[model samples]
Target: MRSSLRPLLVSIVILAAASVGASSARAAASGRPLGNATRATYPSVVSIELLGRSMLYSVNFDQALNENMSAGFGLGSSSMNIHNTDLDANKSATFLPAYFDYYFLNAAGSPYVTAGVTLILNHSSVKGTDTSTGNLEIPSSPVMPTVGGGYEYRSDTGFLFRVAGYLVAGRSLTPWLGFSFGYAF
Candidate 1:
Protein backbone atom coordinates (compact mmCIF):
# COMPACT_ATOMS: atom_id res chain seq x y z
CA MET A 1 0.00 0.00 0.00
CA ARG A 2 2.85 2.41 0.87
CA SER A 3 4.58 1.82 -2.46
CA SER A 4 1.39 2.47 -4.40
CA LEU A 5 0.77 5.81 -2.57
CA ARG A 6 4.30 7.01 -3.29
CA PRO A 7 3.87 6.50 -7.04
CA LEU A 8 0.52 8.34 -7.00
CA LEU A 9 2.06 11.39 -5.22
CA VAL A 10 4.93 11.57 -7.72
CA SER A 11 2.49 11.51 -10.64
CA ILE A 12 0.51 14.39 -9.15
CA VAL A 13 3.66 16.50 -8.70
CA ILE A 14 4.80 15.91 -12.28
CA LEU A 15 1.42 16.90 -13.70
CA ALA A 16 1.42 20.15 -11.71
CA ALA A 17 4.91 21.06 -12.93
CA ALA A 18 4.00 20.43 -16.56
CA SER A 19 0.92 22.66 -16.31
CA VAL A 20 2.97 25.51 -14.84
CA GLY A 21 5.61 25.21 -17.54
CA ALA A 22 3.00 25.26 -20.32
CA SER A 23 1.30 28.39 -19.02
CA SER A 24 4.61 30.21 -18.64
CA ALA A 25 5.59 29.25 -22.19
CA ARG A 26 2.34 30.69 -23.53
CA ALA A 27 2.89 33.95 -21.66
CA ALA A 28 6.46 34.15 -22.95
CA ALA A 29 5.32 33.70 -26.55
CA SER A 30 2.80 36.55 -26.15
CA GLY A 31 5.55 38.89 -24.91
CA ARG A 32 3.38 40.12 -22.07
CA PRO A 33 3.22 39.09 -18.48
CA LEU A 34 0.21 37.07 -17.46
CA GLY A 35 -1.76 39.99 -15.97
CA ASN A 36 -0.03 43.09 -17.28
CA ALA A 37 -2.09 43.80 -20.40
CA THR A 38 -5.26 44.35 -18.49
CA ARG A 39 -3.59 46.72 -16.02
CA ALA A 40 -2.10 48.95 -18.72
CA THR A 41 -5.32 50.52 -19.95
CA TYR A 42 -6.20 53.98 -18.68
CA PRO A 43 -9.02 56.01 -20.20
CA SER A 44 -8.21 59.54 -19.08
CA VAL A 45 -5.31 61.72 -18.00
CA VAL A 46 -4.93 65.25 -16.71
CA SER A 47 -1.65 67.09 -17.11
CA ILE A 48 0.04 70.45 -16.68
CA GLU A 49 2.60 71.53 -19.26
CA LEU A 50 5.31 74.16 -19.21
CA LEU A 51 5.55 75.37 -22.80
CA GLY A 52 8.25 77.32 -24.58
CA ARG A 53 6.42 80.62 -24.24
CA SER A 54 3.56 79.74 -21.98
CA MET A 55 2.03 77.40 -19.42
CA LEU A 56 -0.82 75.06 -20.28
CA TYR A 57 -3.00 72.91 -18.08
CA SER A 58 -5.29 70.39 -19.77
CA VAL A 59 -7.44 67.32 -19.45
CA ASN A 60 -7.55 64.59 -22.04
CA PHE A 61 -9.84 61.63 -22.62
CA ASP A 62 -8.71 58.67 -24.67
CA GLN A 63 -10.20 55.47 -26.01
CA ALA A 64 -8.04 52.57 -27.02
CA LEU A 65 -9.35 51.27 -30.35
CA ASN A 66 -6.92 48.38 -30.24
CA GLU A 67 -3.68 47.26 -28.71
CA ASN A 68 -1.61 49.68 -30.76
CA MET A 69 -3.88 52.65 -31.43
CA SER A 70 -5.66 55.28 -29.37
CA ALA A 71 -7.65 58.43 -30.11
CA GLY A 72 -8.07 61.36 -27.79
CA PHE A 73 -8.95 65.04 -27.39
CA GLY A 74 -7.42 67.77 -25.27
CA LEU A 75 -8.24 71.32 -24.25
CA GLY A 76 -5.84 73.78 -22.62
CA SER A 77 -5.06 77.43 -22.15
CA SER A 78 -2.00 79.54 -21.47
CA SER A 79 -1.21 83.06 -20.43
CA MET A 80 2.21 83.82 -21.87
CA ASN A 81 4.51 86.70 -21.18
CA ILE A 82 6.39 88.24 -24.10
CA HIS A 83 9.02 90.71 -23.05
CA ASN A 84 11.51 92.73 -25.07
CA THR A 85 14.02 94.73 -23.01
CA ASP A 86 15.39 96.64 -26.01
CA LEU A 87 11.99 98.14 -26.65
CA ASP A 88 11.11 98.49 -22.94
CA ALA A 89 7.84 96.75 -23.63
CA ASN A 90 5.92 93.87 -22.11
CA LYS A 91 3.19 91.79 -23.70
CA SER A 92 0.89 89.05 -22.53
CA ALA A 93 -0.88 86.53 -24.68
CA THR A 94 -3.75 84.26 -23.71
CA PHE A 95 -4.29 81.23 -25.88
CA LEU A 96 -6.94 78.56 -25.94
CA PRO A 97 -6.00 75.49 -27.96
CA ALA A 98 -8.23 72.53 -28.60
CA TYR A 99 -6.79 69.48 -30.30
CA PHE A 100 -7.10 65.83 -31.16
CA ASP A 101 -4.33 63.31 -30.67
CA TYR A 102 -3.47 59.91 -32.12
CA TYR A 103 -1.19 57.57 -30.24
CA PHE A 104 1.02 54.75 -31.45
CA LEU A 105 1.81 52.29 -28.68
CA ASN A 106 4.84 50.06 -28.43
CA ALA A 107 6.83 48.14 -25.89
CA ALA A 108 9.07 51.04 -24.97
CA GLY A 109 6.84 54.12 -25.02
CA SER A 110 3.99 55.72 -26.92
CA PRO A 111 4.46 58.43 -29.54
CA TYR A 112 1.64 60.70 -30.63
CA VAL A 113 0.67 63.17 -33.37
CA THR A 114 -1.73 66.06 -33.01
CA ALA A 115 -3.65 68.62 -35.07
CA GLY A 116 -5.42 71.63 -33.62
CA VAL A 117 -6.35 75.30 -33.68
CA THR A 118 -5.61 78.03 -31.19
CA LEU A 119 -7.51 81.21 -30.41
CA ILE A 120 -4.92 83.76 -29.47
CA LEU A 121 -5.68 86.97 -27.59
CA ASN A 122 -2.78 89.27 -26.93
CA HIS A 123 -2.21 92.60 -25.20
CA SER A 124 0.88 94.77 -25.01
CA SER A 125 1.95 97.89 -23.16
CA VAL A 126 4.85 100.30 -23.46
CA LYS A 127 6.55 101.64 -20.33
CA GLY A 128 6.53 105.36 -19.55
CA THR A 129 10.36 105.46 -19.66
CA ASP A 130 10.30 104.50 -23.36
CA THR A 131 7.70 107.04 -24.44
CA SER A 132 6.36 110.46 -23.41
CA THR A 133 2.94 108.97 -22.77
CA GLY A 134 2.56 107.28 -19.37
CA ASN A 135 1.48 103.99 -20.85
CA LEU A 136 0.10 102.69 -24.14
CA GLU A 137 -1.87 99.44 -24.44
CA ILE A 138 -2.57 97.42 -27.58
CA PRO A 139 -4.68 94.34 -27.93
CA SER A 140 -5.29 91.88 -30.76
CA SER A 141 -6.94 88.54 -31.38
CA PRO A 142 -5.91 86.00 -34.01
CA VAL A 143 -7.02 82.52 -34.93
CA MET A 144 -4.15 80.21 -35.71
CA PRO A 145 -3.95 76.68 -37.05
CA THR A 146 -1.48 74.30 -35.46
CA VAL A 147 0.04 70.82 -35.75
CA GLY A 148 2.24 68.95 -33.31
CA GLY A 149 3.73 65.65 -32.27
CA GLY A 150 5.09 64.19 -29.05
CA TYR A 151 6.12 61.17 -27.04
CA GLU A 152 4.69 60.01 -23.75
CA TYR A 153 5.81 57.53 -21.12
CA ARG A 154 3.48 56.13 -18.52
CA SER A 155 4.72 53.85 -15.81
CA ASP A 156 2.85 50.89 -14.49
CA THR A 157 2.22 52.80 -11.28
CA GLY A 158 0.30 55.56 -13.16
CA PHE A 159 2.94 58.28 -13.40
CA LEU A 160 3.19 59.93 -16.83
CA PHE A 161 5.69 62.14 -18.63
CA ARG A 162 5.28 63.81 -22.02
CA VAL A 163 7.32 66.02 -24.32
CA ALA A 164 5.75 67.76 -27.28
CA GLY A 165 6.16 70.52 -29.84
CA TYR A 166 3.72 72.66 -31.80
CA LEU A 167 3.87 74.83 -34.91
CA VAL A 168 1.46 77.74 -34.96
CA ALA A 169 0.72 79.61 -38.19
CA GLY A 170 -0.02 83.24 -37.64
CA ARG A 171 1.63 86.46 -38.86
CA SER A 172 4.85 84.50 -38.43
CA LEU A 173 5.59 80.86 -37.86
CA THR A 174 5.90 80.26 -34.13
CA PRO A 175 7.21 77.03 -32.62
CA TRP A 176 6.23 75.93 -29.13
CA LEU A 177 7.79 73.10 -27.18
CA GLY A 178 6.55 71.72 -23.90
CA PHE A 179 7.20 69.12 -21.21
CA SER A 180 4.48 67.80 -18.98
CA PHE A 181 3.91 65.35 -16.15
CA GLY A 182 0.68 63.86 -14.91
CA TYR A 183 -1.21 60.88 -13.63
CA ALA A 184 -3.39 58.32 -15.41
CA PHE A 185 -6.55 56.87 -13.96
Candidate 2:
Protein backbone atom coordinates (compact mmCIF):
# COMPACT_ATOMS: atom_id res chain seq x y z
CA MET A 1 0.00 0.00 0.00
CA ARG A 2 2.87 2.43 0.78
CA SER A 3 4.52 1.79 -2.60
CA SER A 4 1.25 2.38 -4.44
CA LEU A 5 0.69 5.73 -2.55
CA ARG A 6 4.20 6.93 -3.49
CA PRO A 7 3.54 6.34 -7.19
CA LEU A 8 0.20 8.21 -6.99
CA LEU A 9 1.79 11.21 -5.19
CA VAL A 10 4.58 11.44 -7.76
CA SER A 11 2.08 11.39 -10.59
CA ILE A 12 0.01 14.21 -8.97
CA VAL A 13 3.09 16.41 -8.45
CA ILE A 14 4.25 15.92 -12.00
CA LEU A 15 0.85 16.87 -13.38
CA ALA A 16 0.70 20.02 -11.24
CA ALA A 17 4.14 21.15 -12.40
CA ALA A 18 3.20 20.60 -16.05
CA SER A 19 0.01 22.67 -15.63
CA VAL A 20 1.89 25.60 -14.08
CA GLY A 21 4.50 25.54 -16.81
CA ALA A 22 1.86 25.47 -19.50
CA SER A 23 0.08 28.49 -17.97
CA SER A 24 3.30 30.45 -17.90
CA ALA A 25 4.03 29.57 -21.48
CA ARG A 26 0.55 30.63 -22.56
CA ALA A 27 0.88 33.98 -20.81
CA ALA A 28 4.27 34.59 -22.44
CA ALA A 29 2.89 33.78 -25.88
CA SER A 30 -0.02 36.23 -25.33
CA GLY A 31 2.45 39.05 -24.54
CA ARG A 32 1.09 39.48 -21.02
CA PRO A 33 3.42 39.46 -18.01
CA LEU A 34 2.33 37.25 -15.16
CA GLY A 35 2.98 37.43 -11.41
CA ASN A 36 3.67 40.56 -9.41
CA ALA A 37 3.04 43.30 -11.93
CA THR A 38 4.16 46.84 -11.08
CA ARG A 39 1.51 49.24 -9.72
CA ALA A 40 1.43 52.92 -8.72
CA THR A 41 1.23 53.80 -5.06
CA TYR A 42 -0.07 57.24 -4.13
CA PRO A 43 1.58 59.20 -1.36
CA SER A 44 -0.02 60.89 1.63
CA VAL A 45 0.26 64.65 2.12
CA VAL A 46 0.01 66.70 5.33
CA SER A 47 -0.57 70.45 5.43
CA ILE A 48 -1.42 73.44 7.59
CA GLU A 49 -4.08 75.94 6.48
CA LEU A 50 -5.18 79.46 7.39
CA LEU A 51 -8.73 80.62 6.76
CA GLY A 52 -9.33 84.19 5.67
CA ARG A 53 -12.30 85.01 7.83
CA SER A 54 -12.37 84.73 11.65
CA MET A 55 -8.62 84.03 11.68
CA LEU A 56 -9.13 80.30 11.52
CA TYR A 57 -6.22 77.89 11.37
CA SER A 58 -6.12 74.18 10.67
CA VAL A 59 -3.92 71.13 10.18
CA ASN A 60 -4.90 68.53 7.61
CA PHE A 61 -3.74 65.13 6.42
CA ASP A 62 -4.85 63.62 3.12
CA GLN A 63 -4.11 60.43 1.22
CA ALA A 64 -4.70 59.57 -2.39
CA LEU A 65 -6.75 56.43 -3.02
CA ASN A 66 -6.21 56.74 -6.76
CA GLU A 67 -5.33 59.34 -9.35
CA ASN A 68 -8.64 61.19 -9.01
CA MET A 69 -9.84 60.67 -5.44
CA SER A 70 -8.50 61.63 -2.02
CA ALA A 71 -9.83 61.99 1.49
CA GLY A 72 -8.70 63.93 4.58
CA PHE A 73 -9.51 65.46 7.96
CA GLY A 74 -8.96 68.93 9.39
CA LEU A 75 -8.97 70.66 12.78
CA GLY A 76 -9.27 74.44 13.03
CA SER A 77 -9.96 77.36 15.35
CA SER A 78 -10.94 81.04 15.13
CA SER A 79 -11.28 84.07 17.44
CA MET A 80 -12.76 87.52 17.03
CA ASN A 81 -14.06 90.57 18.95
CA ILE A 82 -17.57 91.93 18.66
CA HIS A 83 -18.01 95.54 17.61
CA ASN A 84 -19.71 98.25 19.82
CA THR A 85 -19.13 96.17 22.92
CA ASP A 86 -16.43 94.61 25.02
CA LEU A 87 -17.53 91.10 24.05
CA ASP A 88 -15.22 88.49 22.61
CA ALA A 89 -16.00 85.25 20.78
CA ASN A 90 -14.04 82.17 19.85
CA LYS A 91 -14.82 79.07 17.78
CA SER A 92 -13.22 75.77 16.85
CA ALA A 93 -14.27 73.25 14.24
CA THR A 94 -13.22 69.82 12.95
CA PHE A 95 -13.91 68.60 9.43
CA LEU A 96 -13.97 65.37 7.48
CA PRO A 97 -13.51 66.29 3.83
CA ALA A 98 -13.64 64.09 0.74
CA TYR A 99 -12.19 65.34 -2.52
CA PHE A 100 -12.79 64.46 -6.18
CA ASP A 101 -10.02 65.84 -8.36
CA TYR A 102 -9.64 66.34 -12.09
CA TYR A 103 -6.12 65.32 -12.97
CA PHE A 104 -6.67 65.45 -16.72
CA LEU A 105 -4.85 68.70 -17.38
CA ASN A 106 -1.61 68.19 -15.44
CA ALA A 107 -0.30 65.75 -12.96
CA ALA A 108 1.75 68.22 -10.94
CA GLY A 109 -1.10 70.69 -10.47
CA SER A 110 -4.75 69.72 -10.40
CA PRO A 111 -8.06 71.38 -9.58
CA TYR A 112 -10.46 69.60 -7.28
CA VAL A 113 -13.90 69.87 -5.73
CA THR A 114 -14.55 68.94 -2.13
CA ALA A 115 -17.53 68.33 0.11
CA GLY A 116 -17.39 67.90 3.86
CA VAL A 117 -19.15 67.95 7.17
CA THR A 118 -17.85 69.66 10.27
CA LEU A 119 -18.41 69.43 13.99
CA ILE A 120 -18.23 72.93 15.39
CA LEU A 121 -17.68 73.99 18.99
CA ASN A 122 -18.13 77.65 19.83
CA HIS A 123 -17.49 79.64 23.02
CA SER A 124 -18.20 83.25 23.80
CA SER A 125 -17.34 85.56 26.73
CA VAL A 126 -18.18 89.14 27.59
CA LYS A 127 -15.96 91.20 29.84
CA GLY A 128 -15.57 94.67 31.48
CA THR A 129 -18.04 97.36 32.67
CA ASP A 130 -20.96 95.01 33.04
CA THR A 131 -21.95 95.20 36.67
CA SER A 132 -25.32 93.53 36.14
CA THR A 133 -24.00 90.60 34.14
CA GLY A 134 -20.43 90.51 35.47
CA ASN A 135 -18.35 88.09 33.36
CA LEU A 136 -20.50 85.85 31.22
CA GLU A 137 -19.50 82.74 29.35
CA ILE A 138 -21.54 80.75 26.85
CA PRO A 139 -20.78 77.45 25.14
CA SER A 140 -22.50 75.94 22.13
CA SER A 141 -21.88 72.85 20.03
CA PRO A 142 -23.33 72.16 16.60
CA VAL A 143 -22.78 70.02 13.52
CA MET A 144 -22.19 71.94 10.32
CA PRO A 145 -22.42 70.59 6.76
CA THR A 146 -20.10 72.10 4.20
CA VAL A 147 -19.03 72.01 0.56
CA GLY A 148 -16.05 73.53 -1.25
CA GLY A 149 -13.53 73.34 -4.08
CA GLY A 150 -9.83 74.07 -4.41
CA TYR A 151 -6.76 74.03 -6.57
CA GLU A 152 -3.57 72.36 -5.40
CA TYR A 153 -0.03 72.28 -6.68
CA ARG A 154 2.46 69.70 -5.55
CA SER A 155 5.96 69.16 -6.82
CA ASP A 156 8.11 66.07 -6.80
CA THR A 157 10.51 67.84 -4.42
CA GLY A 158 7.80 68.00 -1.68
CA PHE A 159 6.67 71.59 -2.08
CA LEU A 160 2.86 72.04 -1.84
CA PHE A 161 0.33 74.86 -2.14
CA ARG A 162 -3.49 74.96 -1.99
CA VAL A 163 -6.42 77.37 -1.86
CA ALA A 164 -10.06 76.44 -1.16
CA GLY A 165 -13.43 77.92 -0.40
CA TYR A 166 -16.16 76.42 1.78
CA LEU A 167 -19.76 77.20 2.67
CA VAL A 168 -20.77 76.01 6.13
CA ALA A 169 -24.40 75.73 7.08
CA GLY A 170 -25.41 77.00 10.52
CA ARG A 171 -27.95 79.59 11.68
CA SER A 172 -26.88 81.12 8.39
CA LEU A 173 -24.56 79.87 5.68
CA THR A 174 -21.07 81.15 6.32
CA PRO A 175 -18.36 81.23 3.67
CA TRP A 176 -14.77 80.41 4.44
CA LEU A 177 -11.67 80.86 2.31
CA GLY A 178 -8.46 79.06 3.13
CA PHE A 179 -4.81 78.99 2.03
CA SER A 180 -2.38 76.23 2.84
CA PHE A 181 1.31 75.42 2.36
CA GLY A 182 3.15 72.31 3.39
CA TYR A 183 5.53 69.55 2.43
CA ALA A 184 4.60 66.21 0.92
CA PHE A 185 6.47 63.10 1.85
Candidate 3:
Protein backbone atom coordinates (compact mmCIF):
# COMPACT_ATOMS: atom_id res chain seq x y z
CA MET A 1 0.00 0.00 0.00
CA ARG A 2 2.83 2.39 0.79
CA SER A 3 4.49 1.76 -2.55
CA SER A 4 1.27 2.29 -4.46
CA LEU A 5 0.51 5.52 -2.61
CA ARG A 6 4.00 6.87 -3.23
CA PRO A 7 3.57 6.74 -6.99
CA LEU A 8 0.17 8.37 -6.83
CA LEU A 9 1.44 11.23 -4.69
CA VAL A 10 4.43 11.76 -6.93
CA SER A 11 2.26 11.83 -10.02
CA ILE A 12 -0.04 14.41 -8.51
CA VAL A 13 2.85 16.70 -7.66
CA ILE A 14 4.37 16.37 -11.10
CA LEU A 15 1.07 17.05 -12.83
CA ALA A 16 0.42 20.18 -10.80
CA ALA A 17 3.87 21.57 -11.55
CA ALA A 18 3.46 20.83 -15.24
CA SER A 19 0.13 22.60 -15.40
CA VAL A 20 1.54 25.76 -13.85
CA GLY A 21 4.58 25.73 -16.10
CA ALA A 22 2.44 25.28 -19.21
CA SER A 23 0.21 28.21 -18.34
CA SER A 24 3.19 30.45 -17.65
CA ALA A 25 4.87 29.50 -20.89
CA ARG A 26 1.75 30.25 -22.87
CA ALA A 27 1.34 33.62 -21.20
CA ALA A 28 4.93 34.59 -21.90
CA ALA A 29 4.97 33.39 -25.53
CA SER A 30 1.92 35.46 -26.36
CA GLY A 31 2.28 39.22 -26.60
CA ARG A 32 0.18 41.48 -24.43
CA PRO A 33 -3.21 42.17 -25.93
CA LEU A 34 -4.15 45.68 -27.07
CA GLY A 35 -5.54 47.59 -24.10
CA ASN A 36 -6.44 44.30 -22.52
CA ALA A 37 -3.95 44.37 -19.70
CA THR A 38 -5.83 47.18 -17.99
CA ARG A 39 -4.72 48.06 -14.49
CA ALA A 40 -4.69 44.47 -13.37
CA THR A 41 -1.05 44.12 -12.47
CA TYR A 42 -0.56 40.63 -11.15
CA PRO A 43 -1.89 37.50 -12.79
CA SER A 44 -1.61 35.68 -9.47
CA VAL A 45 -2.49 36.42 -5.86
CA VAL A 46 -2.53 34.93 -2.36
CA SER A 47 -5.51 35.35 -0.09
CA ILE A 48 -6.12 34.55 3.59
CA GLU A 49 -9.61 34.23 4.93
CA LEU A 50 -11.38 33.26 8.14
CA LEU A 51 -14.35 31.03 7.33
CA GLY A 52 -16.33 31.65 10.49
CA ARG A 53 -14.77 29.00 12.73
CA SER A 54 -12.28 27.59 10.25
CA MET A 55 -9.24 29.29 8.72
CA LEU A 56 -8.06 29.07 5.13
CA TYR A 57 -5.14 30.36 3.11
CA SER A 58 -4.86 30.15 -0.66
CA VAL A 59 -2.51 31.14 -3.42
CA ASN A 60 -4.15 31.75 -6.77
CA PHE A 61 -2.21 31.98 -10.00
CA ASP A 62 -4.12 33.24 -13.01
CA GLN A 63 -3.47 33.38 -16.73
CA ALA A 64 -5.47 35.31 -19.25
CA LEU A 65 -6.60 32.81 -21.89
CA ASN A 66 -8.10 35.59 -23.97
CA GLU A 67 -9.43 39.09 -23.75
CA ASN A 68 -12.51 38.27 -21.72
CA MET A 69 -11.54 34.87 -20.33
CA SER A 70 -9.01 33.76 -17.74
CA ALA A 71 -8.13 30.66 -15.77
CA GLY A 72 -6.45 30.15 -12.44
CA PHE A 73 -5.06 27.62 -10.00
CA GLY A 74 -5.95 27.91 -6.32
CA LEU A 75 -3.95 25.88 -3.82
CA GLY A 76 -4.30 26.05 -0.06
CA SER A 77 -5.26 24.44 3.19
CA SER A 78 -8.34 25.06 5.31
CA SER A 79 -7.46 23.41 8.62
CA MET A 80 -4.21 24.04 10.44
CA ASN A 81 -3.08 22.78 13.81
CA ILE A 82 -2.63 25.77 16.05
CA HIS A 83 -3.29 24.09 19.34
CA ASN A 84 -4.59 20.93 20.99
CA THR A 85 -8.34 20.48 21.14
CA ASP A 86 -9.48 18.46 24.13
CA LEU A 87 -13.02 17.90 22.91
CA ASP A 88 -12.80 18.19 19.15
CA ALA A 89 -10.68 16.42 16.57
CA ASN A 90 -7.75 17.94 14.71
CA LYS A 91 -8.55 18.24 11.00
CA SER A 92 -6.78 19.58 7.94
CA ALA A 93 -7.55 19.84 4.26
CA THR A 94 -5.97 21.23 1.12
CA PHE A 95 -7.72 22.39 -2.01
CA LEU A 96 -6.59 22.65 -5.61
CA PRO A 97 -8.96 24.55 -7.85
CA ALA A 98 -8.88 24.97 -11.60
CA TYR A 99 -11.25 27.79 -12.35
CA PHE A 100 -12.39 29.83 -15.33
CA ASP A 101 -13.02 33.52 -14.84
CA TYR A 102 -14.88 35.99 -17.04
CA TYR A 103 -14.53 39.73 -17.00
CA PHE A 104 -18.00 40.50 -18.30
CA LEU A 105 -18.17 44.13 -17.22
CA ASN A 106 -14.80 45.39 -18.32
CA ALA A 107 -15.15 48.93 -17.17
CA ALA A 108 -12.23 50.86 -15.67
CA GLY A 109 -12.65 48.95 -12.42
CA SER A 110 -15.27 46.30 -12.97
CA PRO A 111 -16.31 43.03 -11.36
CA TYR A 112 -16.18 39.44 -12.58
CA VAL A 113 -17.41 35.90 -11.98
CA THR A 114 -15.54 32.62 -11.71
CA ALA A 115 -16.60 28.99 -11.79
CA GLY A 116 -14.59 25.81 -11.51
CA VAL A 117 -13.73 22.56 -9.80
CA THR A 118 -11.91 22.16 -6.51
CA LEU A 119 -9.86 19.03 -5.99
CA ILE A 120 -9.48 18.60 -2.28
CA LEU A 121 -7.40 16.48 0.10
CA ASN A 122 -8.82 16.02 3.54
CA HIS A 123 -7.05 14.65 6.62
CA SER A 124 -8.08 14.33 10.23
CA SER A 125 -6.64 13.17 13.54
CA VAL A 126 -8.41 12.41 16.75
CA LYS A 127 -5.25 12.13 18.84
CA GLY A 128 -6.80 13.31 22.06
CA THR A 129 -8.13 11.17 24.91
CA ASP A 130 -11.62 12.55 24.61
CA THR A 131 -13.10 9.66 22.63
CA SER A 132 -12.41 6.00 21.95
CA THR A 133 -10.78 6.94 18.65
CA GLY A 134 -7.06 6.86 19.39
CA ASN A 135 -4.30 8.88 17.73
CA LEU A 136 -6.07 8.94 14.35
CA GLU A 137 -5.06 10.30 10.97
CA ILE A 138 -6.91 9.81 7.70
CA PRO A 139 -6.59 11.25 4.21
CA SER A 140 -8.93 11.32 1.25
CA SER A 141 -9.32 13.10 -2.07
CA PRO A 142 -12.46 14.49 -3.68
CA VAL A 143 -13.49 16.95 -6.36
CA MET A 144 -16.15 19.61 -6.07
CA PRO A 145 -17.58 22.41 -8.20
CA THR A 146 -17.64 26.05 -7.16
CA VAL A 147 -18.85 29.47 -8.34
CA GLY A 148 -18.02 32.97 -7.20
CA GLY A 149 -18.00 36.65 -8.16
CA GLY A 150 -16.19 39.73 -6.95
CA TYR A 151 -14.96 43.22 -7.77
CA GLU A 152 -11.45 44.22 -8.72
CA TYR A 153 -9.84 47.46 -7.68
CA ARG A 154 -6.64 48.71 -9.23
CA SER A 155 -4.34 51.04 -7.36
CA ASP A 156 -2.06 53.75 -8.65
CA THR A 157 0.95 52.05 -7.10
CA GLY A 158 0.54 49.13 -9.50
CA PHE A 159 -1.32 46.93 -7.04
CA LEU A 160 -4.66 45.19 -7.47
CA PHE A 161 -7.25 43.92 -5.01
CA ARG A 162 -9.80 41.22 -5.75
CA VAL A 163 -12.47 39.99 -3.35
CA ALA A 164 -14.39 36.81 -4.09
CA GLY A 165 -16.58 34.16 -2.47
CA TYR A 166 -16.81 30.55 -3.58
CA LEU A 167 -18.76 27.46 -2.47
CA VAL A 168 -17.84 23.81 -2.82
CA ALA A 169 -20.55 21.20 -3.18
CA GLY A 170 -20.04 17.82 -1.48
CA ARG A 171 -20.51 16.06 1.81
CA SER A 172 -18.71 18.86 3.62
CA LEU A 173 -19.66 21.64 1.28
CA THR A 174 -17.55 24.57 2.41
CA PRO A 175 -17.91 28.24 1.63
CA TRP A 176 -14.79 30.38 1.35
CA LEU A 177 -14.24 34.10 1.11
CA GLY A 178 -11.03 35.47 -0.32
CA PHE A 179 -9.35 38.80 -0.93
CA SER A 180 -6.13 38.93 -2.88
CA PHE A 181 -3.74 41.87 -3.24
CA GLY A 182 -0.79 41.67 -5.56
CA TYR A 183 1.29 43.49 -8.15
CA ALA A 184 1.40 42.73 -11.90
CA PHE A 185 4.54 42.05 -13.85
TM-score of each: 0.54, 0.57, 0.56
lDDT, residue 58, candidate 2: 66
Model 2 regions lying over 4 Å from their true place: 1-42, 52-55, 80-86, 90-106, 121-141
Candidate 3: give the clashing pairs.
Answer: 41-184, 42-184
Model 1, residue pairs in steric clash: none
The CA lDDT at 180 in model 1 is 62
As for candidate 2, its clashing pairs are none
Model 3 score (lDDT): 0.51
* lDDT winner: 3
lDDT sort, best first: 3, 2, 1
Clashes of 3: 2
Q: Across residues 1-185, which tens digit of lDDT does each residue of candidate 3 receive?
A: 53523653564455445545554564566565533545344344333222211124466667766556678776765543333343333455566767887887544356888888766544333121121121112123355677878776543332445777766554445565655544434
lDDT per model vs. reference: 0.49, 0.50, 0.51
